[model samples]
Target: MDDSNENVLTGSASQSLLIKPDISTPLIDSKRIDLQTLINKFHNQLGDKNWLKYQSIFSSFILGKLSRNEFENEITKIINSNLLINFHNQFILSNLANSVRINPSPNSHISGFGFNNNNLFNMNNSNKKKKNLNNYKFNNQYEVLKTNIMSLPVKERRRIKNIKRDSGKSNLLSANSSLYITNPQNNKSSSQPREVITGNAVTWSQDIMTGFQTLLASESYELPDKDTLNYRMTGIMREHGLFGSLDENSINVMSMAIESHLKTIIEETIDLVRYRKSKYDEN
Candidate 1:
């Protein structure tokens, strides 16, 4: 009877150990699980489609007390699923991958959109308008500059003629005064005749005038046409020391120097023209 009771006690203890308890195990911390947060993050990063199925699987893993290995297997299953077959889905996936690698800061305040920087968009648009304005100003200034440069040769000829005439008169005065010297030499009187000096003076003046005229007549300088005006303006601006230290690609530097001047002049002229037109209309 003692052996039998000992055996029964051992058997009861073994049976008790074999039977599963009905009591619930304490769940993992809500913070540690974080399945909802992970789902939201995945949705934000990967869009709705890819995150949809994955979110369900993640939820099941968290709620069902699935092992880590099982959770990872579910993730693999979702990844291997053939859900994203459309071009739009592919584009979204590509953008999602890029976002995951370089997560942009959320800009939910301004545009009320999830991930767009409306400020940056506005800035880009403003910059584009500025660029177009600069280009328009450049084109107008280039046209005016071509007209001015092309007129230079004719204008320079008149200037050179005036300068030569003035110089010739000064030379004639000097030659006439110097012709009569204090010393007598070789049968010629110290007081030389006015005719001889006057003749030599006329000859020298004629030679200089002829040379100046020839230079004015030369067509070596070819001014830029309308098609090539912008290219020529770039060269002229560089030569004028406007953009001293900046790189050649610095459009802002070029525009600051060239466009500002042009815009001011053009606006003033336009205002004047409009004023004149309004007065004429009133008349």
Candidate 2:
């Protein structure tokens, strides 16, 4: 009886060990992507030739053979095509990137009068505006006007009432002409404001190419046409008005810009194709 009992106990223990719980074992199947599915997904984003050319690179990245940062950088380069195009339509259209600067010439002549401590003026002989004013004295009306103006608080001096009544029948032009204004310069001089474009034209071409590349990478896979380009370029110059309102020079510039960008995209696409072919062949 004891032996039989021991045998029964051992058998039950063995049976328990052999039988597993009702719960199923978890699997990694959910994590795995089907090959066909992956191929189709990539094919949609990139065209057939591009998919083939970039397959190995993408595969390596997905399979953990490539580091995450390296993969992201490679993807960025592919998308941007290594084009550093960071510019705004507003900046370009407003010509803000091409800022103007007025630089005084070192050789330009400047003359002025200096007042002494005794309240006497030592006018520079070459100063044309003050040349004949040595014997000049302010008229009574103007003197009174100046005195009253000087008595007012600084801000209140600009009030129209201060000059409206005092500035008798003289028209605005005549009143302005009567003021004895002197200038440091003996002669009137002018300098043209110089506008300098800060960036290279290649930036525009690159920017357009990057956008074109992005479009190709999308599902639509459409290229921009002349009308589309015109519309978009007009939008950039919205502050100025529509494309029709643009002057001949502006229109020509925009046309050239669009043509150059399109040309750049084509050239870049050809080069990319060639590069892919070589890389694929080597692999």
Candidate 3:
């Protein structure tokens, strides 16, 4: 240690005081280095020296043309890699980069070229449209015009009032009953503030379906009992020839009721005629 100090003291003061060249600051003059040329130099230098695992940084910093931060990060990765020797031999040469570092202060590093190159051939992919979160698209397709009925005018739907119904069958048979018969073609009193009959129901044949349709049009048919419902339903089913395909017991019951009512009406009509004739004879 004493011998080293004595030799340094004996050295010329001017030589010792000579300022070192700054490798971190590049020359801004016309002799500026090309990025490709710099990378080529690094590649050639590596040919004569031991391969440093991280020396590919030349491609990233020069040929690959990355920004400064990217260059330092890559260099840091090589330095921290699992290798016996981290840096290339040419990198350690005293004249190569000297004591230059990447960052400005002591807390910084030397992973970079440790210097700036004014002329860099950085590959710019920035101009290309970058695929970010916004670049994504949904895979679904959309329809333009709706072909549904809902697009029609609302007023086109005319409301048909349902026939009103009552449970009393006797009430339906009265003169004032909404179910009372009418000859639309004849001058017949409907037992109300009488009005002239319209010719709507005048048809060639007395069709059962025509009667039912007319009845439904004139007034609501009220059901007196569930049996009455079976009566009307079975009647419709019979007219349509579908009655035998369904439950027979209920159909038979309604048929019996209808037959009994018809018989009673016929017998009462006969008794009324005999009584009226006997009264005429007594007079």
Candidate 4:
């Protein structure tokens, strides 16, 4: 063959060889690693005493401090460690990134440069679970208190108020009830009933009791039992001297006391409600 013809034939063969196949095989096969092994390896390399502190490592890895191979190895180590199972996706991802040196794309699979959509979805779901867990812990107690308080009748609440009044010698007024007596000079035989201050004392007492009951019923807590509610109320009242001398100062104090008391109860109740939700989830 002529030299030019030989060169042309060789070029044609090289071009044919360069053409890619319609179906391409993956460079790295994706596989699920054992979670326990991953965790153990992670602890061995980074020390397990303070796992929370190293949570940022996962983020660092995604940002790219390690090669794809090295990152996969470390991630596999973490997954097999069993520790990652306990953590939510955000925690796992952040810690893993921090521990490794790799320029991981925000969307890169732990397996390598190859993309896996499932892992991303799993990570998002894990984060949601963690957030829900935290919220549940906070609201558990509050719901209990609210339910219990709401179940009490207005009359029964009055009886409880009388009991509290008889038990204590303090001049401080119970938020549950108040007494108001009218002078006879205001109206003689008005038939409005004697000692009435435009409104009946019983009615006023009921109103106050109802307000407190409503507050209790609506409030949330980490622990919703009676003991917790009582303790929390007492603490708040005492802090503001709600059960002290009855005067203008005392009135102002009581108002402030109720405000503070209600605030604490509300906050605690929210925590309790969260707890209840968490417990329900566990069950």
Best by lDDT: 4
lDDT (CA) per prediction: 0.36, 0.34, 0.33, 0.37
Model 1 TM-score (2 dp) = 0.15
Per-residue lDDT of model 4, residues 1-283, tens digit only: 3422322211112122232221122122123232333444444444432332233333334334445455444444434332333333323333222222223335433332112222211334366765764464336435764677678998976766577434452121122221221223343546555334423323332222222232232334232344334433443443222432224454456556767888999999999999999999999
- Which residue pairs show backbone clashes in model 3? none
Better model by TM-score: candidate 2 vs candidate 3: 2
Clash pairs (backbone) in predicted model 1? none
Better of 3 and 4 by TM-score: 3
For candidate 2, the per-residue lDDT at 206 reads 27
A best-first ranking of the candidates according to their lDDT comes to: 4, 1, 2, 3
TM-score of 2: 0.19
| Candidate 1 residue lDDT tens string, 1-283 | 2422322211112121222221223121111111222333434554544444443453444334455556555555434322322222333223222221212225312110122212211324365765765465457556875787677898775775577433332101121122112113323655777555544333332222222222110132433233233333433333222322334455445446655776899999999999999999999
TM-score of each: 0.15, 0.19, 0.17, 0.16
lDDT of 4: 0.37
- Backbone clash total, candidate 3: 0
Expressed as tens digits, the lDDT of each residue in 1-283 for candidate 3 is 2422222211112223232232233332212122334344543433322222233343333333456556555554433322212123223321122222112234322223432221122223343322221132111101211223245555532221234544453101121211112233234545542222211211111122222222221133332344434444643553332424347677677667866887999999999999999999999
* Candidate 2, position 189, lDDT: 60
